[model samples]
Target: MKRINEQKGFTLTEILIVLVVAGILLSLILPNVLQAIERGNVTAHQSNLNTINVALFMCYTQERDWTQCADITDLTDGNFLEEVPENPFGGGYDIEDSPDVAAGDINAGKVACSTVEVTVGGDTLPGTCSGA
Candidate 1:
């Protein structure tokens, strides 16, 4: 008498196919996930810029002139800011006295600060700032 055998597991070819499909799906999904994360980073950087701008404006209001805040770190006034906001891309902010642009010109109205040029994963994107 002969006994019948039952199939209880996937074959090697079937397993390979599943793996390839999973890999393809992951490849398609990973870029979008990464892009979303990058966008979030950019948003955070923008928020930081806004915070700094507000603080600078407050400082100007109190002083009646633009403060020579050379960098974000120079903002030590507790009422203004605890410290300088760092560049989300990994560098410090670049503060300068703008005497040309409206609302940013130190001599005209306000002091303007900008982010240092940053590169993300070899791609150069515009940084978060008033002009940028």
Candidate 2:
């Protein structure tokens, strides 16, 4: 049989050292990766808001009434949006249409996320969208 020094496997000390190095590297890198992902999600959320506003605008141009496109299907029927995007946090978009023109909120269609307050990077994004 070969001598113990001739064996071709790592020693316990060497394996422990490797594990320690890997743990240190992950500790340094994991937070940055997670932050980048959160930033991307926030960015996507903002884009979705813009898209909803644009779709509402298109629907209003067709229906001539902001309240007419109260539902996502209403906008989809007019090809305003191909498909509704899923909110990154959770739930779908909330579309609110103002029908009462006399209330001083005429033709104001707003789209917002279910999660009312979305805070990213310690700043709040515009949580609602309007046709105008």
Candidate 3:
């Protein structure tokens, strides 16, 4: 009796080669995607900080005074802010009355701004929101 010789499925070596290729492709693609996501998060964080700063600045304008803001609630309670934006990295958003630099102080300088900070990936990044 004559038997037909036909490949029924992929060989073990072929499967391993395909897996290796897939792994290489994934290795090349994953980092860029992750980086893009991280950049997006950072941008969103900055936008939120800017929004908070603007609201605080407007509040200061309404009060016609320059005071350090410790909490975002003051803006909300005063109706300057409808709500506080949530941090993307599961860290609390902080507002400081003074900036890290002498030039960033709203009270001292013409800059109407605040020092905002948040922790991202266990790293604390500070940003300044200025009225100018």
The top-ranked prediction according to lDDT is: 3
Error of 3 at 74 (Å): 0.9
**Best of the candidates, TM-score:** 2
Collision pairs in model 3: 68-97
lDDT of 1 by residue, 1-132 (tens): 766886689999999999999999999999999999889889988888788778776776776555545455556643688777766677655556433444435446343544444444566565555632
Backbone collision tally, model 1: 2
Give stretches of model 2 more than 4 Å off. Answer: 1-5, 98-132
Worst 10 residues of 1 by lDDT: 109-118
> Residue by residue across 30-131, what tens digits does model 2's lDDT show?
999999999998899889878977998798798877567778788777899999876786767767433323322444433322223344445555444344
Return the lDDT, model 2, position 77. Answer: 78
List where candidate 1 sits over 4 angstroms from the true fold: 1-8, 99-132
Ranking by TM-score: 2, 3, 1
Ranking of models by lDDT: 3, 2, 1
TM-score of 2: 0.72
TM-score of 3: 0.71
With candidate 2 superimposed using the best TM-score fit, by how many Å does residue 55's alpha carbon deviate from the native? 0.4
- The Cα RMSD of model 2 versus the native structure comes to 6.2
Tens digits of per-residue lDDT for model 3, 103-124? 3355556655445566676887
